[model samples]
Target: MDAQQWRIDVDREVCAGTGLCVGTAAGRLRLDAGRARPVREVVEPDQAVVDAAETCPMEAITVRSLTTGEVLAPEL
Candidate 1:
């Protein structure tokens, strides 16, 4: 069976290296060079992805549904 691949975006310029996303979504998000980035091109992120995006201090994370193209985070 194939899992639905989710899509997430992170703006390095907007990121503050707060580590909130990394903490909330451990395997899915990572802190590199003091910036937040997705570990992979989605692969099937959980609700923690959304929580991480929502919890971002800089609001630099954006989560979207790859199949439906629905924006799931930042409320826009």
Candidate 2:
């Protein structure tokens, strides 16, 4: 994985299964079993993923910078 790759996580407990993330980034996220999950945990930097995180109604999605461990989405 590249140092600048993005890491995606979804808090199942906090997720409302609204599928907003999936709609925002279908290739990067999915709604499954009443929760959202990343299609892949680590992926190349993608704006769609960030949008997905930001669009999540429950704020269940989190995107991070793999190398710096910085929270990249949901704006804190």
Candidate 3:
């Protein structure tokens, strides 16, 4: 069987902690003291996660595939 791979990152320095990620991808992200924290280093996020990452004003959140190390999106 193939291993499932995933990755989620947040730049605390850049994160505004708007709660957007937590609201959008509750299963993958949560608010921790006003900061967005990934439930795990590797996550299988849905469209919501993608949207949150894309819409983050600070461009702090990053989503990627763990196995491939492909950055799904980077902060702009």
Window of ten residues with lowest summed lDDT in model 2? 1-10
For all predicted structures, in order, the TM-scores are: 0.87, 0.94, 0.81
True-vs-predicted CA distance for residue 55, candidate 2, Å: 1.2
lDDT tens digits by residue: candidate 1, 1-76? 2346788999999998988888899899898999988899665758899898888888999888888878878786
Per-residue lDDT over 1-76 for candidate 3, one digit per residue giving the tens place of the 0 to 100 score: 1245667888887788898878777788887888888888676546777787888888888888777777777544
Clashing pairs in 3: none
lDDT agreement with native, every candidate:
0.85, 0.90, 0.77
Alpha-carbon shift of residue 38 in model 2 (angstroms): 0.4
Decide which is better by lDDT, 2 or 3.
Answer: 2
As for candidate 1, its clashing pairs are none
